[model samples]
Target: MSKPKSIQVFEYSTLICGQEYNGHHFKKAHFNALVKLNEIHKGNYFTIGVNKITFKNYVGVLQVDGLVIEILPKIDQYESDSESSKIKWQAALIEMLRVTKRLKIKEKDEASVATQSKHLLDIYFEWFLAEVQKLIHQGLIKQYYKETSQVKALKGKLEFAGHIAKNVVHKERFYATHQVYDKDHLLHQVLFCALEIIASLTKGSYLYSTCKKVQLDFPEVKTIKVSAKTFEQIPHDRKTAPYETALAIARIIILNFAPNVKTGSENMLALLFDMNVLWEQYILVRLQRAQEKKGFTIIGQNSKPFWQNIAIRPDIVLSKGENENYIIDTKWKNIDQSKPSTQDLRQMYVYNEYWNSKKAMLLYPTNAISSEINEKDFVAFQETPNVKDHHQCSLGKISIFKEGRLDEEIGNTILKWFETSKNE
Candidate 1:
């Protein structure tokens, strides 16, 4: 029997691509997870009442301390030819990792992989640890820092106040900056904390032992958890370029590393990433890459006031010049087969009118089972008589199931828009 405390409940939704438990059969299971989660969050985060659980537009993982509950897409059993539900989720995650320049890990044979049983966190942990280990083997970067301290014996300068206060004045207080080299630097501190956390949480895994062995050399380095503010304090230079990737990975780990809770005799730690936000970031990254090759400028979330001086911020605005541009809003949800939602179209319409652009687009993730909505669905917006300057809208679908295609698909979609705008 599975421990009720360890169980996590998530509702199935088309917007996400994964499997979850739902309905009355798992009511007790859901309650158990929520009870523990609420306690961990101190009744602040997940305070909503759960009468009937149903996941909707949100496609992300929610975690309270060590217990994580992932919300993913429901399986489409009827569509046998469709890609495996897990494959779509993994592909999206892999694309996210690549786009962020976090890691270049590609999805290998999913059908017969030993890591098939591993969780998403495990995959990321393994990758981060491996990168850190490789960097360690090359030898941890060292830098010199000035050190000053009071000593029994005079090494440099003697303090007059200390000599008078001591009475004997045998021991001298020295004020001097001595250059020293060791693993007690800021970069080493972050790495050591990340490795320690991973080692503690992931015992028995290959990474646990590896981290233990690798961290042995840095005995003097004190482990310290870091936050966003911590990064601002850390010194960065061109010489530390090689440690950049490791530092970035370590920063994320430290920021998300939760406090451990005592559960029986063991301890629990949880770390989670918001997939919806990550997906948006991933899209922006791919769009930026496309911009580089195509020689176009794309502004993200720029505050542009509309009619009545109301402030508006659209996701992405692709511009050819001052006036020639199109509005793009990325929807992490799967579009319905029949048509785009009224609210989304209206939102885009507002953007188009305000920006003086004739075109707007709604981008969605395409899977094998997703219905292919055509250009006709956007005809209503184009046919509006009040609309001028060849006003139009488009529903674009990019395949998220196929590995390593996110960048290409998004680039192509934007390029096509550019072409269409030029013709107009």
Candidate 2:
């Protein structure tokens, strides 16, 4: 698919424990619209991603440039043809931002636009999630749910009344009342599926400083903040690109936080281990084996705009070299943190089927915090009837050490995978 024709950002909104909050507060929603939107999306019931739960720092009125995920603004305004946000969360976000006037970029004072505000940064996330909720509500998503309310007498005696009297008495009867619970299960399913892709895309964090290398100019975007002090401290030179500060931070994160890479494939895991670069970096490392021609392009055609195929993008397309090419996607989420709801594992299989890959692997972070699983043993768990019930398996060993020593740690692990593969 080509890029979406129209997109704009709006003030970001958030939900925690079932209440909506605007860009300003954390405990609850200030705006009625956001509250209504939260209910509509059932945000309380649906989680954002495993990483959202896994990675945490302090959050206040804003998402700091180096700390939280920065939502990118859309290029243009989109029309709201439907009252149903379920049909279009992006449009709703664009519309929502339009109401706030945060989406507007000043040609006159571009530098301030980049550094001064966090509204669109907020809107981008809200809009994206809203769009998802709308899609699930459209009825394309199907999941198993059964809940029924039981009608019982106030006292011990069972009560039966004639149809006419029953209406007056407020009587209802059911032989069985299975509690279907809330309708948000399907929404969670959708969110997690989207979450895996997005989380994997960015590795587990959404910090802009980690989005790209420092010094790389982000066109169309003015700035995204992860922290207040960082934002305030960045020099505001109009001639310099807005992301310059983010880029510089990204560099610090790279040199300090990420693993060391010696440029190409042999040492690319160093880049992949860097928490900032890991998301897209891991995907890139896997693609090194692909020939430009005669192979499936995991990211789609080179020209395909980045966000167009965000949801269903295949992880990898094995091409010419192998007899059987399989697509592989890595996820940083732990099923323990964000358990793999049926929808999650299903989407992984779906992508594999969509690309007609002979086999596929949904590579998880496999942290020791997760469990002590050896690689082969973990694969065997997949073959088990009820895999979720059993958490002890050896697929591969994964453990997390201090951030400073991460380079040495990750490098050793990658070396192990390479060695193990060679022996096999």
Candidate 3:
């Protein structure tokens, strides 16, 4: 069964900025996540000693070591010096302190040290941030909440005397900086950063939650438990794992640099399948020229790998006119020709057989790891002494291309790949 939503490992955050700090309001997702963690912990309270919180729902008295989230009256001390000032103030804030066993609200504030405050919300947010900086030496909170002296109250030995009041305003402005959260919520910042890492690790190839919340917040997430057996299905040998292969397929557009407006997820997937084409010096030039003169057109899938047992997809299949076809794939990992497993050879061979037109290729990131298909890997195309080839071999004839140039250089190269290659 799925776990409960509230306690599930989630990206969380909160905001605390006021006009005084910057006449601004802001939200911090990272900050909120920390608060959520503290709330979910089961044992001793995470001491944010000496912090105070002032929220409409509570008057968090900042003690030396703990925070207490509770309600307090709006009345302020008109007389900060009279003997009854301390008692009267406590009496006014007492109703907010009464918390029993049945309440189910966001865990209200509970701090170790607080002076007192008029604005309850400010008190709470400050106390929360204070808990975040929990070293007795930090003294940011204890140093901040100095009491107001007026004497005549009781806490047994800890007699109440001062009527301390300090304003905790954000140093930064809370204007347009935090307006988005007030209007639409900006929690996505934390979620996006986290997901970006996952997407790279997964090669932009993991199952996502179809539900909006799940999809947006966790794009590279998979619910399945990864095991040794399941892990064995993917390429475990080189940098040619399924994800790298998949990513290679996804970036087919780079081959010719002509943007194809993919309509749906399915079309996008199909286009990626066509990206695996043999890279040839001539084909690269042809692709570049075609795009420069006339925008390139889409062709069918050309992911031919006579080397593997399973079907592999290329990112794009470029066409010069209605009948011509050339393939392209993206590679995010290092590409090396040596130490390749037999499976890699077999997969490329299979790709060649299935596509049948001629030419199969493997692509990879040259920046990450320097790799090249040495000239020796190339053999004379069966019947022709003049034509040469590589062992990432093909049924008809295959070419290989690794983009080691900048965008303009690669872009020009792809245009040429389209212009000169024979139409399939």
Which has the greatest lDDT? 1
* Model 3 CA deviation exceeding 4 Å by range: 1-295, 299-312, 321-323, 336-341, 368-406, 415-424
Ranking by TM-score: 1, 2, 3
**How many clashes (backbone atoms < 3 Å, residues ≥3 apart in a chain or on different chains) does model 3 have?**
109
The Cα local distance difference test for each model comes to 0.58, 0.32, 0.29
How do these models rank on lDDT, best leading? 1, 2, 3
- Top TM-score model: 1
> Candidate 1 has which clashing residue pairs, if any?
16-73, 17-73, 18-73, 66-269, 66-270
Residue-level error in angstroms, candidate 2, position 202: 28
Cα deviation of 63, candidate 1, in Å = 8.2
Show the lowest summed lDDT stretch of 10 residues, model 3: 4-13
Q: Model 1 over residues 272-307: C-alpha lDDT tens digits? A: 444555666777777877786676787888777665
Q: Per-residue CA lDDT of candidate 2, range 224-304, in tens?
A: 223334434433454334334323323322222211212121111011111222323443443442334333434421221
True-structure lDDT of candidate 2: 0.32
Identify the runs in model 2 with alpha carbons over 4 angstroms from their true place: 1-313, 318-320, 336-359, 366-419
TM-score of 2: 0.29
